[model samples]
Target: MPETLPAPCAPEDARRVACIGAGVIGGGWAAHFLARGYDVTAWDPAPDAEEKLRRLVAAAWPALEQIGLAEGAAPNRLTVAGTLAEAVADADFVQESAPEKLELKRSLLAELTAATRPGVVIASSTSGYPMTDMQTAAGDAARLVVGHPFNPPYLIPLVEVVGGERTDRAAVTWASRFYEVAGKSVLTMDRELPGFIANRLQEALWREALHMVANGEASVADIDASITEGPGLRWAFMGPCLTFALAGGEGGMAHMLDHFGPSLKSPWTRLEAPELDRALRDAMVEGCAEAAGDRSYADLVAARDQGVIDVLRATGRLGGTTR
Candidate 1:
């Protein structure tokens, strides 16, 4: 690896950002950086990648505009690069949203790390893979960190940042602060945990949901309503831990845990994932189709984007300062 370059200006002052692999996550990152008034160049290999990315960004624009764009924010500020090297050659920061395949990630990240100017931060949008694994092939693993974002990245503001074994502490700090500057709620994790935090919890719940479906215990719509009409409303503002704390009546987590700890052994949970057999797969697909009703995938995405914007606004997060 080449010697590390001196650290540059704070990420907030960064003028250019590169988004590699212009899929959903990459395109979302491009949309986000553009909305923040940064010049963004994106690269992906698909013949239709550029067109798809533009459409995705165009779809996300109204929600971002509703939240208030930066002074110079414009879609025209985005550029589609013909190659990965071209994309990150001059980028002050690079956000990679490539495919989840580990080998692909390892090779792509190494290439990205080599191409970008030294000391520039490179963040991956991996949901579950620890940075330790992804950074293995990077030239300067010290500058690589995971910057996981939620779906519909333009509307959702939460970003989970963590560094791998070889990552420099300064790189972790830099990425965390940079996400905040980019208008995201930063979860600067101290250590890398499997699936990070949110995905672990979500997967646990998701597994149980699949189990219920396999056992004919619940429909997809039932699962959705059980949350939307039940705990989902509270969860929008207060997380599950705090909500359970409130569940202890006058007491808090200690009391609630004391009362509910014994129930942990209850047979209600099926932690092991149900085999996704043809029947189960068809059921899930049909359930989603039924749930989507007359709406197309694009329609559902649009609805979700606007709904998330409304939730952020209601919760006092939309357009709020992240510094």
Candidate 2:
């Protein structure tokens, strides 16, 4: 914390955002910010990063238009800065989407903190790394936080916000409020959890899926079908916990847990991830290729975007802060 750190502006009033890194997650973030009517400045070291980022934002514009944009929101609001320092020079908020290497995160965050305005919050789009580990290199760790989002952040509504050991409690609160203001569903965690909330659940399911695939217990398409055709539908409107609560009929969660708790001892799932050996890797690759059939990457992305839009509409989550 700097002695001269200014009082931060209200999260909802924030207008200009700096996105440091132009990869998929970073670019998706840029698209989301643009859709929310913020002027976004992005910086990436890759030679063609600007071109790719612009293309990504262009591809996502149609879905954004359907979801509804904020006043004056347009894809043209994006600016590809030539350097990271230039990007954050006037940023009201900074979002770092660098690669997942710890050292890279440490150095990049330190640089960002040094470059960004003193009171502006700086967030990382890390999938799992705790802010405590990533904030060590920052000159002022108080304003650094984790703002983890799922892929295609422009569509996903959930963002898990958490602060590290050195992070100021107020900063955590600020980040959470900012995410909600930016039209995202926020899970403001009190303490760091391994993989956060959603990813932890996703990892368990992913591990089980891999184990099944490795053991030839289920085909790739079958596993996908099990979710997309079954629980996934309910999950669109109700979470797994509530969905299970319904299983108890009038008994609610207590009865449901009591009845199902005993069955927890069954060897139903392999929690540990199967080794990504050559055979397993090849199987996963080949299986996905076969499942994809004729759909190109662009086609799949478009299909997914439309599907998410439909689900959001059907569930009545498109209005308000959901989109």
Candidate 3:
């Protein structure tokens, strides 16, 4: 048997969490941990990272307040560590949101593994790479798992949790429970799947969008509308499966699948991805800019945050959230 390190405290019982990397995702995670009333220690190598991270948490605080902050939640609880070792030395749970580079992740996790006390659960905010590939370099791979979150993770409820081949089932369970206690909706996966569940579906949708834009088959505005004005509304309360299940009227998924399964042979969707050549990339960027119109990026972010909060309230997921 591989040597097991001493186990850390249960996630629900954890008081301090470590966030490795302080870019958008990492900073969002820091905001989340702070909102959940945990003392968060964050480490980042970039210049001005401490300043940037604090600003991010500050920006996210209003939205978090709307979502209802935990009793003791406060931004003053965050600490920026000068070194990776210093950040995670006493963390009960460690969340790594480092850059997606394979080698960086490999070395970072290994470093974290060495520095963190035994039994502490470590999770990566990796969007796609399977944990198996990333765990080889870790000193204790059994305690590492992926805890993928969507953009603007401070308010987004979905968190996909999965373990690598070498990861202990207990760790996976621990991370899932931890995310739940932290007010996230957890999708605990059974096995490793590329992009996991949500991203795989999202990537497929995105690929088709790129194909359309590249071929002049659709404008960015058209594509955005096709979802926002159409399926996106239903998607707030129900997924594509459940939404389509209603398409069969009195029939359920079985009937709906039987009715539309034949359409699977249609060439409507371009499965092959469009290359991100300069021209295509420019077109995508310009199209988005046009779609943004008068709204700046900050304006868009605030609008989106409020929109999500409204959606959560409407869906009864916010537990009586008012505005």
Candidate 4:
């Protein structure tokens, strides 16, 4: 491994950012950096990657504009690089959003680390792969970290950042600070957690929902409504743990847990995932199509972006505050 490297610049002072692998997540990251007034260079191997990336950025620019752009933000600031090396040659930070295959990730990170400046931080957008596993192939694992972002990275504020065993503590701290400097809400994790925090919680609920569907208990639409009409409202602002604490009616989390702890043993949730057989697969697809009604994919995306923007504003997050 190369000698431990220092960051080229403070996160706030970073100027050029590289987005490797120009798919949805990669494109979203590019849109985000561009909206924040950073010089963005992106690369992908797909024949039409540049066209698709530009379209995705163009489509997302409106939502970003609604949220408010940095002083010099503009779509014209983006550059599509022809190769991986060219993309990160001068980047102060590199964000890799390649496909989720393990071997592919390992090789890509290794190549990315080799091509990028030794001190530049390289973050993977893998949803669940631990940084420890992904950093194995990197020449300088000290600078590698996992920077998991939600879909439409331009609008979503929460980014989960963590480092592997070989990752430097300073790298983790730098990545977290950089994400904040770029206008993101950061969750700096001490240890690697498979699926990270949010995804693990979501998977649990997702498993139970699938189980209910498999058992003929609840329709997919019902499951969606159960969230949208119920706990989802509270979750938009208050997280589950604190929201449940409110259930104690003044006694708070301690009393609430004491009273409901016994029910934990009840067979209410099926943590194990149900088999995704042909029938279940078809059902899920059909259910979503039905729920989507006549809305096109673009229409749905627009609605989701606007909805998130409204939520952020209502919560006062757009102004970097809360009511």
Candidate 5:
């Protein structure tokens, strides 16, 4: 174990951040921190990781700037570190985006715990692992928590904040406030759970999607289009619960539940999720290709970002509050 360093200054007064992995998610984390005016130092063992990190920042900055998320954001606030310790040294906040393997995360968190100040909160970007599992390897586990972000995090601003059994409530609250101030939707979980909220919800939809394609009910493109053209539009503003509430007229959730409750026990629905077999995977690839037509993944992602920006602006809900 390493000696404990001094406490970090207040968040507003802190200028430095450390990102432990420079992969896709780590790069996004670095971009968000740098865009918010914090100098970032990141580390990854992969060859050319530094260059990749720089490119990710370059690519994400323009989209963020277009939406005023990067207004007054300064350059030269990002750096790549040669080692894990080098990354977290003197950092105010450490954001880890390493691989999902438990042993790998344990080793990394141990190193990070040794390297950073005790007062510096170490936030993991792990989407599936429970916070308790991630913090177990840390010497000071209380400072570790889940700060999972959605992909293309610089543009889509939903972060699920989860605390381990030993995690400090103050840490969770401060983490929520920190992300909110940086223009993010922070959903704090009441308890630690695998996949958190968004990923679980996403997995549920994905399971059904896979089932539909596997059973020849729909093509991958058809499934995506079904949501993109239908529920996706409604979900852009309010979630499924709220949307159904409105669907129930003045009776709200009670009326909706009464009308749809019977479906809960229905055997017609494909309640059991299908496995992602090779055939389904190939079909999905082909379906996506068909959906793409001439548009590249880059083009599709940009379009989605623009649509989200438009919806947020139209609803007067962009960057206001996280409540």
Candidate 6:
């Protein structure tokens, strides 16, 4: 694990936070911070982005309150800034949730780095891009790090802290504490890897799901059920490795590994990654539509959010500090 540092500011002192690119992820970041009692300044160039971000934050509060994550934080704590520099000028932490394009991110980070104070950590919300690219454009490269949060960050607790080659350990440490205090589960990356850990793991399962549908081995609905009803249940409490250990009975992982070793070479195992084709992509969309039945996207998102709240509350992880 990377060294953990103290929070950049005490909970009471964590007031000024800046968010650049108030899109989906940026708006989520703003919600998390504002809901945690921080004064959030959000900036975006899109026409009506400020109003959209405010609406998004407002919509998120009820769900967050339902999950017992929001305390007494008020909506007025959120402020929209006209310029990127103005948003970050007094911020203790600067979060860039801009587009995934490398060039755009580089430009934003450069501006944010120059605007913010010396010790303010600049975290990027890019899903797959490496920090090295952003750091190259940052005025103080040491303060720029990847702080990718899962979707709907105000609801999900996981946040991946990735450090680039030039990143300072102290910056990563401070960032971990900052996120933890904001009600997030922080995972530090040992080294910079594209997609980090969780996304890569998700992609692994997604690849198999797509392949199964493409091969006609299972419909999209069946595959969804296979997970939502099967491994998903076990995964709620124990991860795959631990679940396998229990599967081995008295033998544990070594025993299970020995038994499954032969299957490793089988074609059923996705040992190699497959390229996504147009046909498979279309099949996936169709399968998902079939699985949807009468449920709309909005309904599905609400249901999924409720499920997450239930699981977290049952596990006593909701609004609970791990550290």
TM-score of each: 0.83, 0.83, 0.83, 0.84, 0.80, 0.79
What value of lDDT does candidate 1 attain over all alpha carbons?
A: 0.83
User: lDDT for every model?
Assistant: 0.83, 0.84, 0.85, 0.86, 0.76, 0.77
| lDDT (Cα, tens digit) per residue for candidate 3, span 1-323 | 25354466776798999999999999999999999999999999999999999999999999999989999999999999999999998899999999999998988888888888877889999999999999999878999999999988898899999999989899999999999999999999999999999999999999989989999999999999898766786677556654454455444445555566566566779764454455754554455545556766566556555765777567566798554
Taking all chains together, the TM-score of candidate 6 against the true structure is 0.79
How many clashes does the backbone of model 3 have?
3
Model 1, position 45: C-alpha lDDT score: 95
Pairs that collide, model 1 = none
Which structure is stronger by TM-score: 4 or 5?
4
Taking all chains together, the TM-score of candidate 1 against the true structure is 0.83
TM-score of 3: 0.83
Which candidate leads in lDDT? 4
Candidate 6 deviant stretches above 4 angstroms: 1-12, 69-71, 273-323
lDDT of 5 by residue, 1-323 (tens): 44243346665566688888889999998888878877889899999898888998998888767766544566477878888888888798888999889889887887887788776878889979988887777787767778999887777889999888877776777677777876778998889877899899998789888888999999999988888667787678556654554455555445555576566567655674355455754554455455545765456556556766777556566766463
Please provide, for model 4 over 205-250, each residue's C-alpha lDDT reduced to its tens digit, 9 standing for 90 to 100: 9988998999999999999989876778667865665456556544
Clashing pairs in 5: none
Q: Residue 292, candidate 6: how far off, in angstroms?
A: 38
| Candidate 3 local lDDT, residue 262 | 61
lDDT of 1 by residue, 100-218 (tens): 99999999989988888889999999988999999888888888889999987887888999999988988888889888888899999999998998989899999989989999999
Instruction: Give the per-residue lDDT of model 6 (tens digit) for 295-323.
Output: 66555546555765677566566667462
Better of 1 and 5 by TM-score: 1
At residue 221, what lDDT does model 3 achieve?
100
Return whichever of 3 and 6 wins on TM-score: 3
Which parts of model 3 are misplaced by more than 4 Å?
272-323
Give the residue spans of candidate 2 off by over 4 A: 1-7, 272-323
